[model samples]
Target: MKVPVKVDGRELTLSNLNKVLYPDYGFSKAEVIDYYTRVAPVLLPHLRGRPLTVKRYPNGVNGQFFFEKNTPEHTPAWVRRANLPAPGSTKNRERIDFAIVDDLPTLVYYANLAALELHVPQWRVDEDGEALKPDTLVFDLDPGAPATIVECCEVALMLREVLQVEGLTARPKTSGNKGMQLYADWDCREEPSVYAKRLAQFLEKERPKQIVSVMTKKARPGKVFIDWSQNNPAKTTVAPYSLRARELPTVSTPLTWEEVEGCERPEDLVFTAPDVLARVEKRGDLFGRA
Candidate 1:
């Protein structure tokens, strides 16, 4: 069924409202759209002016999924886009017109497409669509099998101490999967990506058994891989408050430092769409405070 709705003065045609997108939780596409609409106030700020890469699960989370970097040709004219040079593009013509979900209408459009995972780089673009310096740095704490979010939490706390020593305040958020990520301000850092790499390496050396800095999958088992690569200009991390393509409708919800220190189990930090909405209503944007 298609429904015509006007939001923020824009007319949009939404479809597949009754289709179940998260079979495990019986969460439907309509619920996804509603989640994005209600969470727009907090989610939009993290997405505005950043090139978005969405993980689309058309048939549902149990079905196949694909990543979308280019804005669809049928994208509405009013929907904002940032024309960025393709990662390895040598020619001017090789560019991707990526969507920028800066408002409720655009957010709904992506949600309607089953774009459950919204990924963005740490940097934002200028009015001319030129990339700006990254405003934030992220440490993507991915736990290899045998390890869980509890292990990630231990590493996150360690990272928080190091960042504090650098006079930077680190914020925590769940990956909405099995791990967690830490974010901090990056303005004064000489090179955010380089610094992140060095920091990860340092941590790996300090706690050889608990952390792995390299991207080698073979070395990941039973350890937390500190993914510093997300700080690179070309890479992206899942946006806070965006849903993951998991069996359940899990959201990448932000956390308070106290929560990070107290997490003892993987399930302790997992949050669904309804959980996140309620969290925002009560505590507000914890990440924004950093």
Candidate 2:
């Protein structure tokens, strides 16, 4: 069944409103659409001008999922799109028209499709199709065996201290899963990937045992791997306030420096869809600076 929903005076057709997307929490598609609509005021800013790669789970969280880069042909004509050369490819070769979620209707349409996780590149596309310099740098702190988000927090604090020494401020957020991520806005002229790689190398050199910059699973035991590779122009991180495709509807929530230091475990920082909406109502966009 399909229903026409009006958002910001624009009409959109949403289907499967009653279909369960999170069996554990019994979260329906309608709830997901509503969540995105409520969070759009905060979420759209981060996504604006950035190309989105949606991870869709049409059969719900437990079913098969796929990543979509090109905007679907059936997408509404009113939705925005950015056509650019694929990252790392030669100019004028292999272009992809990526969906740009710049409005409430576009976001709601995605949510209705069970595109639970929204990922966006660090850089934005300009009107001339040139990729702008990334304004944010992300460090994905992935924990290894026997390690948890607590260890990631420890590493994040150390990273924050290091960044502060360089006159940069880092913000923390739960990965909506087992790890934590730290983001800092960059004002320099260097490319994001280059800067992140150099920073990761420096940190790994400073703390060889606790921090590993190499992207190898074998070297990750008992350490937190600083996934600096996510800074690449081709890469995307989970957008703030987006839902994770887990058994429960958990959100990627921003955190204060105090909360980062106070977290004893991952659960303490995990926020559900409702929790995130409430948080936005109270704290506003914690990542607004980034």
Candidate 3:
């Protein structure tokens, strides 16, 4: 059943308010919508002008899920959408109309659809329909067995030092799961693909044993794969403050450099939905500059 609601002077129809989306935590669809509504002030800024890919978990976190690239045809007319050429498809000139979550109502609308995770590219769309230069460089640190987020944190510190030498400041965040991601806001004059590949090659050469620049799982055992590949124009990272479709409703949370260095275990930096909302009340947007 759908119910009419008003958010920031926008009228939206919210559905499945009582459905449990996080079984382990007994978190309902209403709670999810509420969380996004509360975090919109901080979250919407990161989402503004960027095409979003909604990862839907319609039947809850443990059920099957799929990614929706083109905005659904049923999207309300008031919701903003961006039409852009699909990335890396030379033959297909067809453009994808992506949903732009620029306000509280749009964010709530997706939440009601059980679109638990929102992902966006590092670059933003411009008035001429061209993608702007990437404003951030990201390193997705995925630790293999025997190496956990603790190991990722250790590597993140080293990665920070390397970035510092390049005159960049890095910010660390829990991947809302079993990894860590570090980002640096940059003003480079290079395409994201070129810059990311170059940095990946450089890091691989600098720490060949500790960091695997390649994407193969075979090479990842006991090492944190510095997934620099996500810096491409086509790729998207989990939006900061967005909820992860996990059993416990964890969030992709930003962290202080001090917290990153002090993390001895994954649990030290893990944050749930409520925890994230409270943190925002106290700390505001930690990734505001990025």
Candidate 4:
């Protein structure tokens, strides 16, 4: 079963987690509806309440499209097929709602809040601090494995060199979780769409061997993954100051490499919900893509 949801007047089909998504994530429509009501208070205010759309599914997303029923006949044409149905949500697709955010705090806050609401396991999006800014171009080197900090930093340096010669304003930040996010500020382009296309083009031409310009599981790191898509004006990536996108019982809390060393494998970070307030308070400039 699926239900109708509206965000800023945009209507979308919300899959029913209990009915459409996975068995583990199943829930009643009313329950999922309640989930949104709570998180919205935490973020919609910060987002300035822009028109938004969220596709709720019961199970895994087949793809995104007009949900039908809830959509107002007067819906904007620009919203048609607003996005590809979110691919990798929980196994239960219907128990979700995507929100609009204007700031990193909201992004982090809402993500953590939503997970708490659903009580499901979630992963953190190790967003590059650089990627959050509109002025710079970012190369997010995401190594899906637990490699050494030295190795990660070395990769950041190498990628930084590539961005420099190309005349892109590239700065590196420790995505504050794992991997790194390299941002390039392009004085040449002001439009986010143009930036994404140009950067994707650049990566295709320069780093043909490594994967570039992909998202979700398509761009997991074994080799370097160049993400220019977050530069898209239509989309947003989490920020360093922004909380690591986490689900309930798990926040993408920051950890020193020393902590990483203590773990048996990368799997250890999945369940961690550290009291990160102290660290967050200490790192005041963390929000600035540092």
Candidate 5:
């Protein structure tokens, strides 16, 4: 069914309201849009002015999915677009027209298309649509098989201390899947990836049994891989508060350092859409300072 709605004075036509996006939980497409709309207050700040990459699951999580870097031709005229040089561009496609979801109307439009996951770079674009220097350093802690979010929590605490010595405060968030990520407000002077890689390597050396800094898959089993490569200007990590296109609608929810420290099970950090909304209502934006 097609439902015409006006969101923040922008007219939008939403469709497939009853279609189930998460079959296992019976979560519908309409519910997905509702979740984003309710969570948009805090979610917009992180997305505003940033180049967005949307992972669209048109046929639900069980079906095929595609990552959309370029805004579709049918994108609403009011939805802001950022024209920036494509990373590793081919001859025909030298630049990418990325959608900048700066407000509620734009966000609801994307959600209408079943764009479950929104990823953005560490840096925001200037008024001229030029990419700025990285302002945040991120470490994507991914656990290989036999390791889980519980293990990631232990490593996140270790990372927090090491970053504290550098006079930077690290913020923690679940990846909404099997991992977690820590982000720190960085000084824009130096390249963030260089520092992130160095820190990752240092931790890997100091805690060889628990951490793996390299990208090699063979070394990851029973260890949490500190994926420091996502700090690059071209790289994008999943936006906080955005839902993951998993079997269930899990959100990339922020956590208090206490929650990170106290986590003992994999499910302890796992938060679904409903859980996240409730947390937001109770605690507000946990990552607001970052």
Candidate 6:
């Protein structure tokens, strides 16, 4: 595939792989392409040809939303962009988090009773309990602090317990960065439009308030937020895998827990074509063809 869009005078290569790109943008290489392919097609119409400014990552985080545009903007960037779900945009943020990839490979992964917690849906729904016989599933985790994968997986296990108690079945994934994402199977007919609000609300009532919320401006070190209300409409959080600007290159990008303690963070990740693709296969996103 050949794409002509350029960040500056630089031209980008289009990789025809089942991978997520723009991991710095919280997407793998293939996923970067997938978004451009799957969600972007639908989003473009909503965007109406406006240029877009994407947040990129290059470093460390104590949580909260942190982003930086590393490179120059596209000449006259898209005026509108698809945003994460925010509060009061709907009844809750649940709807936004519940939808699953409709593609075949993704479906196979979700069907794995053991892995559902990692597959993680985008919304939390309370509609009819009808969705529970789930052809659909999603996993979600709230990262509390620096911990081991064992600890994180335990959190995932706890999440699965929560779902079962609530009558939803799901599987979990490691996220490869930090935290775990769980998924449940369902036949949801709801649109993605209302997801953010519902997700924010669900997060609000579900977790104890964090010491931090999304950064409205720069933040002091050692302070992080657990606030989910920022997921509300008109508000957003940086997508996972998106980079933050850090002083060191290797140390500048987001990493798995094994590295967070020794990591350095200063600014944020700048979105680039290369960062885009890494996130794709990293998440095994193309496992399903959604």
Query: Which predicted model would earn the best lDDT?
Result: 5
For all the candidates, what are their Cα RMSDs to the real structure? Answer: 1.7, 2.2, 1.9, 11.1, 1.1, 13.6
TM-score of each candidate structure, all chains considered together: 0.97, 0.95, 0.94, 0.41, 0.98, 0.33
Candidate 1 per-residue lDDT over residues 66-183, each given as its tens digit: 8888877899999888888887643344789988888888998889999999999999999888889889999999999999999999999999999999898998999999999999
CA lDDT of 125 in candidate 6?
A: 21
> How does model 5 fare in lDDT?
0.93
lDDT of 3 by residue, 1-290 (tens): 98998987888888889999999999999999999989998999889888899899999999999988887678889888788889654446478888888788889989989999999999887865567778888889899888899889888998888878878888888889889898888787666567666776787787777777788999889888888889877889998888998879999999988998898877898999999999999999998784
Q: Model 6 segments beyond 4 Å from truth?
A: 1-53, 57-146, 165-177, 183-231, 234-290
The lDDT-based order of candidates, best leading, equals 5, 1, 2, 3, 4, 6
lDDT (0 to 1) per candidate: 0.91, 0.87, 0.86, 0.39, 0.93, 0.31
Q: Which runs of model 3 end up more than 4 angstroms from their true locations?
A: 88-93
Error of 5 at 233 (Å): 1.2
User: Ten consecutive residues with minimal summed lDDT in candidate 1?
Assistant: 85-94
Between candidates 3 and 5, name the one with more favorable lDDT.
Answer: 5
**Best model number under TM-score:** 5
Per-residue lDDT over 1-290 for candidate 2, one digit per residue giving the tens place of the 0 to 100 score: 98987888889888989999999999999899889989999999989889998999999999999988887789888888888777554334488888888888889888887899999988887866567888788999999978888889989999999888877899999889888888888886577777777888898999988989988999999899999999887889999888999988999888888898898976788789999999999999998884
Task: Tell me how candidate 3 scores on lDDT.
Answer: 0.86
Report the lDDT tens digits of candidate 5 across residue range 110-184: 999999999999989888788778888999999988999999999999999999999989999999999999999
CA displacement after TM-score superposition, residue 193 of candidate 1 (Å): 1.6
Q: Write the per-residue lDDT of candidate 4 for residues 78-99, one digit (tens) a residue.
A: 3222122343433435323333
Residue pairs in steric clash, candidate 3?
none
Task: Flag regions of model 2 displaced more than 4 Å.
Answer: 87-93
> What lDDT is reached at residue 228 by model 5?
91
Query: For each candidate, how many residue pairs have backbone atoms clashing (under 3 Å)?
Result: 0, 0, 0, 30, 0, 111
